[model samples]
Target chain A: MDRQAILVELKKVLAPYIKNKELLDGITENTNLITDLKINSANLVDIVIDAEAQYNIEIDADSAENMVTIQNCIDVIEEKLSSANS
Target chain B: MHSAGNDVVAFRLTDPERSAQPRFYNQILSPSEIALFHSGALPSLSFHIFLWLCWSIKESAYKFRKRYHPDLVFSPTAIPVTEIRATAQQITHEGPQNASTDPQITGTDHQITHPVLQITGTDHQITHPVLLITNAAHQITHPVHVITGRTEDLFFRSELFPEGIHTVVYRHPDFKSVRSGYAFLQQALGSNHPQTNGATEPTPETQSAAVRELVLLDLRKRDPNGAWSFGKHKEGYPLLYRNGVLQPVPLSLAHHDQLLGFSYLLPVS
Candidate 1:
């Protein structure tokens, strides 16, 4: 799957948790989940769990710890997908 | 450098929807802790309290370790909350002995009891100095002095409110007595800022933002040096800096739901 496709899926997964509509509208690869979107830290757990189920990928604790940004999530998703394919 | 770390969890924030989610719990807790959590022994404690207890311990240990390991990326599973044992009886006796020597400390030293948590990790076994504040309704009946090992009997007092559960790691107990305080502000709702220090100034737009601002202000109120900077390692845990140099003093701030606060164990002369 292409990176853009993963981004699309990520947006869908993150839609329910986005607290700030303005941030959701303007979110980019650089948009920080916590700093920009104002998502509570506790909700991050739900997002990670949801992402795993959506993408059919497993995220180790190290990767999950750094998933502070949209780009970080996309990168991890893409990497996980690539590794799964291989 | 000596430091402390803390985390708070408001009971109202406990999401019933996510409570049944197994994957969510797995990510934050160790297998052993998970079992212990489900065990019948801790019937009085809720899952939210149990989770935050471990989280606070990890956070405290992380804050202490981050000083030396700034490059480290903290994984909660990397360090588990191995044990949280009460030291009230032991510390209560020690409190009066030291209180007699120090003129500044007041009241019955017995009132400051704080629990100590054992943290086990892949490469380290660390004892984190911790204080657990339960809701006023569910308050631990035994009130003990918050004594650090270094200060021996000097009690560092943390006022427990009736709201949520609070866990604080006072990493630097001996350098000086820990100055720990917290405040609950009216939720800023549409505006995002909560009234800080009961000041009339415009509050920050978000509770997290407001809590951080309040913590910085509280730290300055206690520290002789008003000038301070927050330095973070490559990852994002904060490093306390003062006078344009890294200070050994470790400071930690936490906010949950409607509450925000800070803790610092000041360096001794």
Candidate 2:
């Protein structure tokens, strides 16, 4: 439910595909998904798949376009979380 | 007349040495948004399943790259390629007669077929994780170079990979390419140039919990009907012959969970 917790969980699922050694070591929140973490759009779909499976929420195709960076990915999750809670 | 008919039937049954029918499957994944995967900064984020495939290919390349220096590729099918260490080609095959030259290999002519991953199943997996950058031959050929990279810089830099690709460029061999290329993507938000590379290999620091298999082949000379099959290697690599010399070609790694396809064929004696 918490944004940070959700982000952490999402990162865990997405981590396997990413080469962490290329990123700044010790990843934490505020890591730029695009620049710092280097998450691409194609694989982002897989992240979306993993997140939906984890939290059980469906992310629409249009909304996914905005989820670019780590922050964007987190922002989208927060939006989905808030909407689902309401 | 009856005896002749029986002899033909017997010959068919006795030829146990015949090769199995080659397997081929259609691409199961989509062709949409493939450029997006290629444009990313680090391919690791999007090409999750493919990362493992590429790493395995790179490892296999190391075994033969130094010793054999393989030049031609005969992948019955080609898909988006990510892992290559150092070699000449990225060529895929159409068949025995139609070995179309890779455009990258045509002009320069300095090519080694770096890690050719031949299999019957890429058609099903292409669109699952990302869009493959097969050489333009996908339209006309059996094997394709779904995607390719040359120098280290093009892979890691942002400028090199535009649009859907910049953010993933952190792992690209160059950081400046990212800074320079993104100058416009962030500012004008208009125009995107796709920086492509030639040979790419996964470094030790980058690979993850990927699963792959190693297989061996024995290429004893002068036997056209002579085929070698061993039960030990779960993943099978095809052996190639060009100009009367033999070359070893690797198939993709065997998955652990996969039930052996031809388990019953092993000789009891």
Candidate 3:
């Protein structure tokens, strides 16, 4: 899947966890999960798990740690999806 | 508790804004932890506590590791929580006749009873991943033994404020450990130092300094000869010592809204 397509699914996974709805609406590839959406550090796990189930991909420890931004999430999902397809 | 090689963490659970964010978990937890959350094995409240529990364990483990490897950097994913068992604290409330019993009470003038959280747990087997620092690296897959202790409570004067979770981890299971010195930030800053700007809502750094001082002051009473100097060791872990001698006694520090605390193992004689 492409970045835009992955972002759509990402938004769905993030909606419930984001405290700032305005930030969520304006979220882009550059948006940071902690600074922009003000997501609590604890809920980040839920997003990772949800993203895996939503996109049907697994995120490793290193990738999970680097998944601080929306773009990072998209990159990991895309990579995982492609690798699985290959 | 005996303090030889133990540490504790006190975190504020009052911030609804932070608690709502989903990205926060990524910064602190490992992959297996996320799976545990998905497993739905623990209750909602227990799960929430479990999150903090994991955080405390990592934090405590970091403190423990810092003593041996000062350059060790803390990455929650790098440290895995192996086992945890719920433990109970037997608290006996013996105080003044009416309300004002606990001296650590803040935010209100009226006397109130402090509710000690029932469910607290301890974990002994927490593993630290191989670390690679600036020009210095160490790899150890061996799981380090750490004893973790936790407490959760919601302090209130009128309205119920957010719950605070306090946790301690000891390098040696037999070592005694404790976390104390709860103070209001506003009151502590004003009385401790006669500075001009007594900002009610100080930054996290400011709050941490004030709280660290209060905790250190309380710690000093136990060992009058032990002059604790603060500095960063190998991987920027905070170091403390009594007198001029370098002490291996592990110490952990934390500060959050309206609270700051320290946990350490008392040096074994």
Per-model chain A TM:
0.92, 0.74, 0.94
Model 1 quality (TM-score):
0.64
- For B1-269, candidate 3 gives per-residue lDDT tens digits of 22211222223332334433455565566567767666754322344445665665565555555555544444666776543432222333432112122224211122323432233222211111100010111111213432222221111011011234434444333222333334445445654443314433445456658766765666565657667777656543466766766776555565545544455544545
- For model 2, the docking class works out as incorrect
Which sequence of candidate numbers ranks them by DockQ, best first? 1, 3, 2
Give one digit per residue, the lDDT tens place, for model 2 in A1-86: 77768767876766755655545355666665534564432244455666767877766644554565566667788888788888
On residues B247-269, what C-alpha lDDT tens digit does candidate 2 reach at each position?
A: 33222221111100000101112
Better of 2 and 3 by DockQ: 3
The runs of at least 3 residues in candidate 3 whose Cα sits more than 4 Å from the true structure, single-residue gaps closed, are: A1-60, A66-86, B1-44, B70-78, B88-91, B94-162, B177-200, B225-228, B241-248
DockQ of 1: 0.48
List model 1 lDDT by residue over A1-86, tens digit each. Answer: 89789988998888876645566778789988866776656567778888999999988776887887899899999998889889
- Best by lDDT, which number? 1
RMSD, every candidate, angstroms: 10.9, 22.8, 12.2
Q: What are the lDDT figures for the candidates, one per model? A: 0.54, 0.29, 0.50
In model 2, the Cα lDDT at residue B129 comes to 14
Q: How close is candidate 3 to the true structure, as a TM-score?
A: 0.50
